[model samples]
Each structure stands twice: as C-alpha cells, then as structure tokens.
Target: MQRLFNDCIYRIKALGPEDSTKLFLSRAFGSTNGSCPMELEDAMKKVLKKCGGLPLAIVSIGSLLASYNSPESKHMWERVFKSIGSEMESHPTLEGMRQIVIISYDHLPHHLKACMMYLSIFPEDYVIVKERLLMRWIAEGLVAEKRGLTSMEVAEAYFNELVSRSMIDRAADIVNYYDGREETCRVHDMMLEVMVAKSLEANFISLIGGQYEVMPYDRVRRLSIHGGVEASKQSSFKKTAAGRGRRKNINAMNVEHVRSLSVFELEGHKLLNQLGEFTLLRVLDLEDCKVIGKKHMAHVCRMYLLRFLNLRGTTITVLPRELGDLEHLQALDVRLTFLEGLPETVTALENLECLQYSNKKDYISDGPSKTA
Candidate 1:
C-alpha cells in the first residue's frame, strides 16, 4: 500500500523542543515567544517534558495550565503537572495525546463542562453558529447568571474561554458583517471525540441518526437527531414490516424528561409530530427542516415550558393563534421560512425577548425585539 501511494503520502514529524516550547507558551500565555515568569518556569518545564514535543499534547496541556500561569498560582501549576499521571509515559502515542486532552476537559469549570459536552450534539465537522448555540445553552439552563452579566453574556464568555483553550476552533473567514464578531465555530476532531465519549458516559445526551442509530437505554435528557441521506433511506424503508417494528420502537422511547431537542434534517421532521411527548422541553431547534407545515404548530403550542423555538428554513406558513400559550417562550427564529407573518398572539408573549423573522422581501428583523 505504501509503495503504491508513496508519492501521495506526506510524513509529518513532531515539533522540536524549541518550537514545541514556543507553541506551548503561545497557547498558555498568548506570548509570541516561549516566555514565562520565573516562578512558573520550573512547573512549565516539567509539564512540557511529558508532552514529548507533540503539538497536540503541548497545546492541550498548555491550555489546561493557562488558568494557573500567575505567580500566585505556582502551587496550582505544580498540581497540574503532578496530575499528568504515569499513563502518559506508558503510552507515548495517540493514547497519550487523548489522555492529555481529557485532562484539559477534566479541569474545565462545572458550567463550562456542561456547555462543552453539549457540542457533541452536533454532527461531525458541523459548523456551529454562535448565537444559535448560546440561545440553546441558555434555554437548557447551562448558563448561570452572573452578578452583573446577562445570561447571554455569561454564555458568550463560556464560548470564548473554550476557544481560548483550543477546545473549539473559530471558523476562519466566517465573521458576522454587522458586528465583525466571530459568528461560527467548529470543534476540533480530537476534542469532539472526547466530548462524545464523555457525553455518553454521563448520559448527558441521547443521539440518533448519523453514525449513531441505536436508541439509548436510559431516559432521554437532551436529544439530537442528525439526519442525512442514510436517514432518508431508512425513513423510506420503515414502510416495510421489518421497518414498522423499528418505527414502533422509536415511537415508544420516552422523551418526557427531555429538556432540549434539535433535529438537523428533513428526514427527522416526522419526530416533530411527537412534540407533545416532550412535556418538559425547553428548546425545540429544527433549523433547515423542510416539509413541516402550520399543522405542527399545534404540538408546539402545547409546550408551555419552551423557552427557545427555531423553525428557520422550514416550510411552515403560519403559527397557531394559541402560540401565546407558551408563556415561557423567550426566543423564536423563523428566518428563511415561508411564513407570511407572525400571529397577533405573539404580542401577548411577555417573556419573548428575541423574535427573529423574515418577510417575502427577505427583510430580516433586528435581534431581540420584544414588540414583534
């Protein structure tokens, strides 16, 4: 195999000590060169040695230590160094690198940990929109209110911190034109692997479609269905006798405890009809889903605890007049849909803080308008 594709192959080697140290410092302290205070130099050296000149290990360990880079936090730095156990020495390959990344995850703050694990809900290589993600986080109660900061502000800080730590990467060339701020991000593949593993271990989320087709054994908490061509094929096949059994199994799954449900493709639109089953749901994100019409809004109106509802890019014509019954609704996004207009009942939503919509002329509403 190597002989046949020798010309196409490129052998990438690990970074040298000098370059590794530079990368580590750049990530740890945002320094151009490998520079640190005298108090932290010893601790940094001890941790860098274990990285074995590998870029991934260095970045992971460096970002983990960034929070403890102050002179007063010398003991914390030493503690981090000691925590990189003997497994790193025993397995000095990809396993060791995974261990390094897991260490970084292990050191995240409790709220940040929940937020990070939520990234696993997205499909592999999916570009996540910052505003959409923050709204969901807020609806899921993952973002705690600070003394002076709004919940959205706190969630933004959580996102920036994750970017700073290299847990998620800011998408290049994808800036919001209005504010010139980062609007999209993608999780690193390795970091995403860690997140998915951790999410499953804790039963934090239940996934369907995509690479994961089996139903989870535990009660659903947060559900994400990533549909694609395969799911479309499976949906068609469900018309057969064998497929009917599978469909029944899916319909029987409990969703009463689910707080958030996000479906990414048109194939999963059938699940939207069962919204009545998600009694405690707070977020219902069905971005870009097609074939769904105003008939489904009946189930949506029944969700009294819903805080965020996204039907962007769907084929819905209008919302139900009973939409006002969702007293806890805080945000509603219908951008890029075929909706003619919002119902007058929308005005009755005292808690609605964000009402995003677009008209036939493609005129988008400004962000967070309560009066809409």
Candidate 2:
C-alpha cells in the first residue's frame, strides 16, 4: 500500500499570477488570425485579477468570456467582473473556484445543462466517440429533433458548442468517420470532476466502480457500471456453470425510477434479467458487453417504455420478433453484433428514426409514411 501511494505521488506547484493571466487570455480570447481586441483588454484584465492564479478558475472564467458575444459592450464585461469578484469574496477558497464554474454552468441554456451533466457517465479520461456519444444523447432524449435537422446533426452542434466553451476537447489523434467529421473527444479532468459533483447533487446518475457503492438520497434515475478485473472480483455475482455470473440487487433501490442503464464490457445475460424490476427505463445500453443471448431479448421486448436500445459489439445473434412491442423506441443500434438481420417486426416501429445495423449502409428510416 505504501509503495502504491508513493508511486501515485507527484510534486508540482500552481502557476504564478503572470502565467495564469497568460493562459487565461490564450484560452479565453486567443485568435490564430489576430491579437486580442483592444476594446476588451481592460475587462479581461479585471477578470484575470479575480482569478487568483488558479488554473481551473482561470479556464472557467475564460470559457465564460469566450461564449459572450454581445457586441463587446463594457457593461457586459463589468457584469462578468462583478459577478466573479462577488462570488470569490463570498467563498474565498477553492470552493470559490467551484462557485465560478457553477456560474458558467448556470448560464448555459436549459437544454445544454443535461447534455453537460451527461458527460459524468463516462469514466475519467475516457476517450468518447462522437458517433456513440451522439447516439446515447439521442437515446436519452437530450437532443432536440427538428424537421430539417437530423438528431445526429443537432447533437454535433451541441458537441461543438461545448468544445467552444472549453468543456470538452478533441483527442490528440484525430480519426474522421465516413462523414469526414472527427469522432473522438474527451472532457478535461477538472471539468469532469465538476460534472460528477453536479450529477451526484441532482441524483441524475449513480456510478458504480471497483468497490465503491454510492447510496443516493432517492431513486437513481440513471446508472453506469464500469467493469474491470478489480470490479469483477469485488462484485457479488453468483457462481454459475459457465463462470461467476454478474447480478445487481435492483429491487433494493427504486428500480421503477431507473430511466437509463449502461454497462461496459461485462457479460450481460444474468444482469439483463434484473430489468424486470425497472419499469421506467427508456435507454438500455450494453455496448461492448459479452455474450448477451436471445433469451435476454425476451425481457427487453416487454419493456414498453424503451425508446433506445443498443446491443452493439455483443454476441446476440437475433432480435426477437416481439421487439415491436416497444412502440416508443426511437433508436436501435445493433452494429458489430452477431445478428444476421433485423426482425420483420421492426417495420412496426413507427416512431424509430435511427436504425443502425451491421450492413454497409446505415439506415435512417423516417417515421412510417403517412400515405402508406
């Protein structure tokens, strides 16, 4: 344990005020094309003074300034300066930095808040794929569907918005998908911490890792299970003929309130049976999981409230014909699975807009034709 502790320790110091200011300006107003605007220089100075050389605080303030584009009025910057100073004076600690970040979060438009908080579901330093992330957002009903815009298009705009605000960033190595858009991104560690804090405060998600079990104040609305060697050893799975089977006591908590569930890289058969206890689930993601079979699809078909179901990268070969019972389903992803073909009942899903399968061409079926 002492060796492990020693290995984890790293000695470093915080940036000085001058360096902090440099980083702040570079992030907040850096233009590859030109210099900072002379008109906004004084306001930027005021912002730097209030930041107190804290990098996270500086970045948070810079993100706010970067998003502000209301003709660059002095009064506008004054409001920002006064707000940060007031919050800093009141808190006067690292908690003050937290307050600064929360202010930026609060200033976001209503629709973006959930999208930001959703970032908390992924593990720290997780490399997020834009395609997968957008699908998840659409599944959770976070993306607003418009007549002229596809949900993926709308989600891409939201991703760009968060990037512009410094909440998320592209991975170092860029890989463009078939559409020529970069598909991978990651959240900054500090911002990820803020997301986890806010997610817990709102009971919006319950995250289960290694041996840490977090008890929520009420029903957990969403659950994310991250499985690893340590997590597997720590889990209370019943021994089966195949191996140690994973199971969660969903009945002990407010199972009826769980709206979303994501399990990463675990065998899902035993755990999937627990869905009988969840009545309000709309999103069920078992991406990259192992050995999910046809019997599991039986329970899934009965989940009438389901709007998004993803079985990507699993061993499931066939989707049950009764899947049509999930009349509310909007997005179904079966890519990279063992499935031969979609059941004919899928044509019955009048509300489904996105159908991703293993075929060379992706299917974007508009809701059943009104003329037909």
Candidate 3:
C-alpha cells in the first residue's frame, strides 16, 4: 500500500501558483472567463499564497470564498480574505484548514446543517456504511417526509450532496450488502474536530469521554459513547457520576432526555439495564456490543417512542417477544446475531421500513398475511 501510494505520488505533477489560483477562483465564483478579476486580484493572490498550491487547502478555501457568491466585487473578496487572515498567516496546518472548512458548514442550508453535524457521532476516520447511516437518519426524523419520495430516498440525496461538496468521501473498501452496492463515507480528521465542537455547542449530540463533567446543558438529546477510543470512553462515562464533586444522583443526569444512543463493544450488563429509563428514546444502536442475553435488551421494546433499534453482532440468541411493543419502530437491525427466527409480533410493526438480518436477503411485507 505504501509503495502504491508513493508510486501514485511520483506520477502526479504539482500545480503551479498561477493554475492553483485560477482553479480556486473558478471553483469559488463558478467561472472567471479565463482571467482573474482585477478588483479582487490582490485578495485572491493572498488566498492563493496561503493555500500554497495544495489541493485540499484550495478546495476548503474555495468553498469558504464561494459562500460570498460575489467574487466580482472587491469588498466581498477582501472581506473573506480578512476573515481567514489570522489562520492563513499562521501556517497551513489542520487548524488552518479547519477554519476554512467551518465556513462551508456554516453556509450549508439550515436543513442540511443538522445532517452534516450528525457525522460527528462516529469517531474520526470511521468508515460510515451508507445504508446504515441513511436508515439511522430516517429513524431520527432528520429527513423530512416529502411528497412522492420516501424518507430513505431523501436521506440518500442528502448523503450525495455532502459527498459532492467534499464534506465526506466514499470509503475505498466496499462490501456487497442487501441494501445496495456496498459503500461507506468518511470525514476528514480536521473537519471532524470542528464537527465535534459544533455538535457540543448545539447540544445536538452529547459525547462522553475521559474526565468529563456533566453540566446543566449536558442533558443528552442524542448520545454517542466512545467518541473515538473504545474502552476508555465507556469507563470515563461510567465514572462521570462518581468522579466530579458534582451531584451523585443518577436521576439528575436525566437519561430520559436522550433520544438516540450508540454504544460500541459494550460489556457492562448494568449499563444495558439502565437503558430502560430512556423511555423517550428514538434510536438505540448497540452494534458489536457483547450483551450477554435477551434480558439485556428487555427494556428496548418498552421504548414506545423508539423508531430505530440495532442489535447487530451481539451474543443474543433470541429476541424478546415484547419487541412488538415498539409500535412506532421503523428500522430494526438484528444482523449478524445468533437469533434464529423473529417473533410473530414483529409483523405488528406496520411502520417498519427496513429490517436487516443475517443473510444478504431482504424480507418485505405489506402485512402479516402477505408475509404468510
């Protein structure tokens, strides 16, 4: 792989400052008509110098500048140049790149902002499976139902828009799955840092990690355990209630406010039972968790508000019949588990949109009779 990367580098030619500047301006303003605008020439030169002919830097900066959409005006271009002056002058590091990327995020349509911010739930460099992410989005009610289009289709369009804008990239290793051609997306690390910051600010997704204290605003709406690290994140959260000189009442933490929770490789049975308190929960994803038995997931069915439930790659051999109690459930993923058969009540999920199990086969039903 290293040799291939090195060989690929050897085959490429570096873009000169002139071409680099032209590319950035053209991408930003849509078209420069084969010439740079005299009114904005000085500001463009400054931006190009900071970008240093680096493709990623250029794209990031171009996206920021494009937000202005009036590159023909001297003041508009100068304002953008001034906004990035501090970071650009400092150095071409990830922090500098982050400033540029953030501008693009801020300019996204209001509806897409939450969708983009949700990407922070996954750890850095995490390969996000397309079908799983979209299904999760649909379950969260992030994609608004539109006329003549299913929420799944709208979610796919959102994913593609992010890809087109270079916010996320398609993962190289593709796996064939039941949904579609196996594809995944990944966000850059620098941008991931900005996303984490934004998510925390909006209180969109509360991320628990090492030595963190629960503030008044910490009441989780959507929670992601193990932000990047695996074992440490869980342990940190577990100790949060005990560590700080803060209140010890677990009830004070308001677990009920959490609408979505994703845990990876969970080995604690205690935590699994605690999920029962989150009655308002909509999405509970325990993929790859090491839950001991069906008892661990007993509370899940009682979550009447639940729209999505994922128990993939767990040790469970049987699903509780109470799962039918999730009347509002839309997506249920029990893939890669030892469970042999689904409960009869599973057909009771009239609103269920996607059901993924062990085999690479899709089971669609209009009602129980059609399935029969």
CA lDDT scores, all candidates in order: 0.77, 0.70, 0.69
User: Candidate 2: TM-score?
Assistant: 0.77
Candidate 1, run of 10 with poorest lDDT: 363-372
lDDT of 1 by residue, 1-372 (tens): 011232475333577778978999998898956579998888888887877777778888888778877898989888777877655543456566777888899888898999999999888777777888898889888998889998889989999999888887877534333334437888877788889889988999887766666767458888887656444555455535333443564587887688888886554656777877878889888877776766678888888999999987677888889999999998998876777888899999998888888742354433431110
Among all windows of ten consecutive residues in candidate 2, which has the lowest summed lDDT? 363-372
lDDT value, candidate 2, whole model: 0.70
Point to the candidate with the largest TM-score: 1
Q: Where does model 1 exceed 4 Å of error? A: 1-13, 85-92, 173-182, 229-249, 360-372
Residue pairs that clash (backbone atoms under 3 angstroms), model 3: none
Q: Candidate 3 overall Cα lDDT vs. reference?
A: 0.69
Error of 2 at 108 (Å): 1.3
Name the candidate, 1 or 3, with the larger TM-score value.
Answer: 1
Error of 3 at 286 (Å): 0.4
Worst 10 residues of 3 by lDDT: 363-372
